[model samples]
Target: MDMLPVDRTNAECWQLGTDQITVLTTCAQTSGQIFAVEIRMPPGGGPPVLHRHDPSEVYYVLEGEFTFYVGGEGGVTRHRAGVGDVVPLDGGTPHTVRNESDADAVAFAVHTPGAVMEGFTRAAAVLGAPGARPTMEEVLALADAHGIEMLGPVPAQL
Candidate 1:
């Protein structure tokens, strides 16, 4: 049996947002269904530009409240999640989540088919500086850079 933990710092961790990221699993060694931990907007942290993945995802809230933007949604929805809240996601639709509270918003995400996180980081770097907010154009560029073809223009900002 595999008797070792994957070191997160050694994994391909990257900042997809000014305060968000794709942290590789430190204990799972990419085992099971859990692949990474996505922490978005620390206490008082800002939200990331809207985006989505080609694979399915799950956002299990670990603390604080946040706003969720699911694809085709009429308006933003506010969900106060604590240690036990889970938000499931399918790859078909686009979505973005933001911390609307004064505390950190932690979530664990499982991605089927490992290495997509690495692709996100590489794409982010090519399209925009890591740890920085990306513009709509930049996001489109990043998507293209990562081999994810753009289907339509970015939604108009509210």
Candidate 2:
């Protein structure tokens, strides 16, 4: 990697349904130290499915509101976060993020030790090529192959 900045023009991007993720920094660029992505989440829906992975993640909300449900040893907790709010999720914690608002939301997600989320996104992008939307089962298989486990959608009551 050069000692220069990486903008969207030079970055990889992927679309997951209504959400778009732009890979700002890659594991190859950071030597597996870290990876980051900017996510644009549409209103009324975020990632309805809950998931857990080994790489820890931190999300900094840049716009709009979000509802997060996190599950750990202490049980599940719901968080209502908005612009400027930072949500840190430890490795292996099951979590789901949602946008119950009327407008889109933007957030930055950072993954420690790199390659994890980006790797999944790279493969997932293929599954979505030419707008071929893969089923949840297919996505789960891909996620499982990359050390991620999808724990189904968030409970409706939450």
Candidate 3:
């Protein structure tokens, strides 16, 4: 299959929850090899729940700082990552990330063998619109459809 070059400058950005998500490379674009997205999160913003999915995710911090929570048999581990840091989340590992700094955060997230994340992100962008708070049930249903399992709420402290 021929893979065309992607110019993100023309990519559309969608508000997925509190973050701006720009799908840089979609599954269709890469023939299911990868899915890449750029996310811009406001201070104190992040995903609402810790979740696990089929695709391994790698995050490269571009600006500001973020706190990541990874769950394991020993419980959850918290770590701080700043610009230029690379954080990898293995497939089936439950984890979440947040921007706890005073400034906004920018990061690039890449999923290997790109599952349905691009579609999931697009759906989330619409369901989580301003003044439209999606219920936990709604969120879980969406996640389930994308082969993701919602674990629990994000950690209280960064």
Candidate 4:
């Protein structure tokens, strides 16, 4: 199969939580081999929950500072990453990321054998919209459909 090229101007952008995520490559575009997204986060922006999935994820911090929390059911480890830092999370490793600084942050995230993250991100964008509140049951269902499991809420400091 031939792969087509994609650029920022042609990518699909979504609002997930407080971040603007631009999907660069999707599973469908890569025949299920990989998926990538560029995320722009304002100060204190991040995912609503700490979660885990089957696909391994890598993050390249392009700008600003981000705090990453990674662990399992037992505990978590926190790391503060700045520009040019690369962070990798193994499959099924629970993790969450946030922009704790006063400045905005940009990061490129890639998932190998990209499961259903593309779909999940799209759905989350809609669900996270203003006044579009979804129940916990619905959120859990959505995550489950995408092979993700939410372990806890996002940290207060984030």
Candidate 5:
């Protein structure tokens, strides 16, 4: 219920596939209200599948550009995001944020329920070593356990 100041130097860092995830605030730290992680993604880095989770999320782009694909009542919309762009993703909407550029990208992935990021990053750690890509079967299993529903494969964008 007090100010939880986290120093960047002391924050825990982990690797999920090619992503460098620095957990700034955790679900336990905030009493399950919010969880946030800073993600450093390389070019061509992101999930291979379009997934939907229960917690609504926000992506604040700090560096580089990302192609955001989100599904709505009509259809999927492709958004080209760059530095300082903020994207709001609703809970239960299928989406994926990908760094399709030649350079790296950095952003804060903030989730309302917090369990989404917490479960995902921890699962990635258990799945394998840093930067290890999980197979489709493994991904499916993880998603199933974590309340995530896989919609389909990530589509190609221009």
Candidate 6:
């Protein structure tokens, strides 16, 4: 069994956005599943592009407000998930979750076995630098390299 101290304060506890940090409690090496804890984000923080996985996922909001966009060719459903709210997502469902509030938002997400959180994290790092945002071509290139499948362009509202 792997044993890691909880007090270890490292940057790994956070990820993506300049103001947000995502602590990973279960990485592929840890729990054999893609699971992580996401910490606060500023209002209108950027959301991930529309993408789908080969496995399912579930998200539980712990604090603040969040909007989950589950979309398809037909339409999109924006779920306003608050504390204690749980959003379960199935494979082949292109979706994204974002913070739409001024306060910090936190959530715990569990992607199924072999999901691409690590790759997502890596790609985010590569495309997450300051100044200009990465182009769609660049984003797809990174996602492709990481085994992620992009469904379409980023949502219009993002």
The alpha-carbon RMSD values of the candidates against the true structure, listed in the order shown, are 4.7, 1.7, 2.1, 2.5, 2.0, 3.3
Candidate 2 C-alpha lDDT tens digits along 13-38: 78876788898888888888788999
Model 5's alpha-carbon lDDT is 0.84
Q: Write one digit per residue (lDDT tens) for candidate 3, span 1-158.
A: 43357676788788877788888888877788888998899998998678888889999999999889999997888899999999999899999999989999999999987857776887888888888988978988988988988888865654
Which 10-residue window in model 4 sums to the lowest lDDT?
A: 1-10
lDDT (Cα, 0-100) at 140 in candidate 1: 71
Candidate 3: segments with Cα more than 4 A from true spot: 1-5, 155-158
TM-score of each: 0.65, 0.91, 0.90, 0.88, 0.91, 0.76
- Give the whole-model CA lDDT for all candidates, comma-separated: 0.59, 0.85, 0.86, 0.86, 0.84, 0.69
User: How would you order the candidates by TM-score, starting with the best?
Assistant: 2, 5, 3, 4, 6, 1
What's model 6's overall lDDT?
0.69
Candidate 2: C-alpha lDDT? 0.85
Tell me the tens digit of each residue's lDDT in model 1 across 1-158.
44246455555555555566656553245544445666766764543445666667777776676566666556433445677788877775566666767777777766654455456655675555645666888777657665454444335564
List ranges where model 6 is wrong by over 4 Å: 1-8, 26-28, 72-74, 130-133, 153-158
Tens digits of lDDT, candidate 5, 1-158: 45457778888888777788998998888899888989999999977668899999999999999888888886778888899999999899899878899999999889989887688768877796755666889978888888988888755552
Candidate 2 similarity to native, TM-score: 0.91
List, residue by residue over 21-90, the lDDT tens digit for candidate 4. Answer: 9888998878898889999999999975689989898999999999998885657778999999999999
How many clashing residue pairs appear in each of the predictions shown?
A: 1, 0, 0, 0, 0, 3
Residue 16, model 3, lDDT: 78
Q: Is candidate 1 or candidate 4 better by lDDT?
A: 4
Could you tell me the lDDT of residue 89 within candidate 4?
A: 91
How many clashing pairs in candidate 3? 0
| Model 2: lowest-lDDT 10 consecutive positions | 1-10
Better of 3 and 6 by TM-score: 3
1 or 5, greater by lDDT? 5
